[model samples]
Target: MKRTLVWLGGMATVTALLVASTGAANAISRGNMPAYCRGEVSAMYATKPMYVKTGKIVKARDGSLSIQGTVDKGSEGIKAFACRFDKKGNFIDVMAMTSDGE
Candidate 1:
C-alpha cells in the first residue's frame, strides 16, 4: 500500500509538471506576435510605384510596428510621416503627420 501511494504521488507530480509547462509555453506564444511586421511593410512599399525616402521601423513590439521617415516626391520637398502596422502583419493605419497625409 505504501508503494502504491508513492507511485500515485509521483504520477500526480509528473502530471502537474506537464500541465504547468504547457501553460508556460502557451503564455510565451501569446507574449509577442510581431515577428511578421517587416515582411508586411516591405510588401506595402513594393506594391506602390511612389518614391518613398525609406523610413526606419521604430517601435515594433507586441505586434505594433511604427515607422517614421520621409517620402520623396519629384520636384517637391520631402514629406515626413509615420506608419503603423497591426499584429497580423497588415496595415492597421497610416498617419501622415506632414505634407503627405495617407
Candidate 2:
C-alpha cells in the first residue's frame, strides 16, 4: 500500500511539472508571436513592386493583427496602407490608411 501511494505521488508530481513547463513554453511562444507575425508580413511586403516603409505592426493577444506602412508611388509621393491578418498570421486584406489625419 505504501509503495502504491509513493508511485501515485511521483506520477502526480511528474504530471504537474510537465503541465507547468508546457504552460511556460506556451506563454513564451505567444509573447513572441506578434514579432514573428510582423517579420513575416514585412518579408511579404518586401516582395511587392513599390518601395515600402514599415510603420506599426499591431498583434492582438487573440491573434488578430494590423500592419501599417507607407508605399512610395514614384511621382505620386507616398501612400499609406493598412493590412489585416488573422490569428494564424494569414493575410486577410489591405486598405488605404493614414495616421489620424496626418
Candidate 3:
C-alpha cells in the first residue's frame, strides 16, 4: 500500500508539471508582439516617446511572419511599417510601408 501511494504521488507531480509547461508554452507562442516591436521600432526611428500599434501576426507563403503596424512619433506624424520575422519568430527587419503599398 505504501509503494502504491508513492507511485500515485509521483504521477501526480508529473501531471502537474506537464500542465504547467503547456501553459507556459502557450503564453510564449502568443507573446506580446506589439510591445516587443515597439522597442525595436522606436530604436530604428530614433525617436522618444514613440507608440506602436500592431495588428495580428501574418504568415507568408514563404514561411515568414510579419506584423503590420503604425508608429507614432508625436510631432513627426504616424507612419506605417511591417516588422518581418522568420518562421521561428526571429526578427528579420522593419521597413516603412509606403502609400503605394510597397
Evaluated with TM-score, which candidate comes out highest?
A: 3
Residue-by-residue lDDT tens digits, candidate 1, 1-102: 999999999999999999888672222122122222333333444433244544555556586666665555445555555656555544564455564344
lDDT of 2 by residue, 1-102 (tens): 999999999999999999888672222244444454445444554534335655566888887877677666556566677766676655566666644344
* Span of 10 residues, lowest total lDDT, candidate 2: 24-33
User: Least accurate stretch of 10 residues (summed lDDT) in model 3?
Assistant: 24-33
Give a tens-digit lDDT track for model 3, residues 1-102: 999999999999999999988672321143765666666787877764247778888889987788888877667678888887777766768888845334
Clashing pairs in 1: none
TM-score of 2: 0.44
lDDT of all predictions, in order shown? Answer: 0.51, 0.61, 0.74
Question: What are the clash counts of all predictions, listed in order?
Answer: 0, 0, 0
Error of 2 at 59 (Å): 1.8
Off by over 4 Å in 3: 1-30, 48-50, 99-102
Off by over 4 Å in 2: 1-50, 98-102
What does candidate 1 score on TM?
0.40
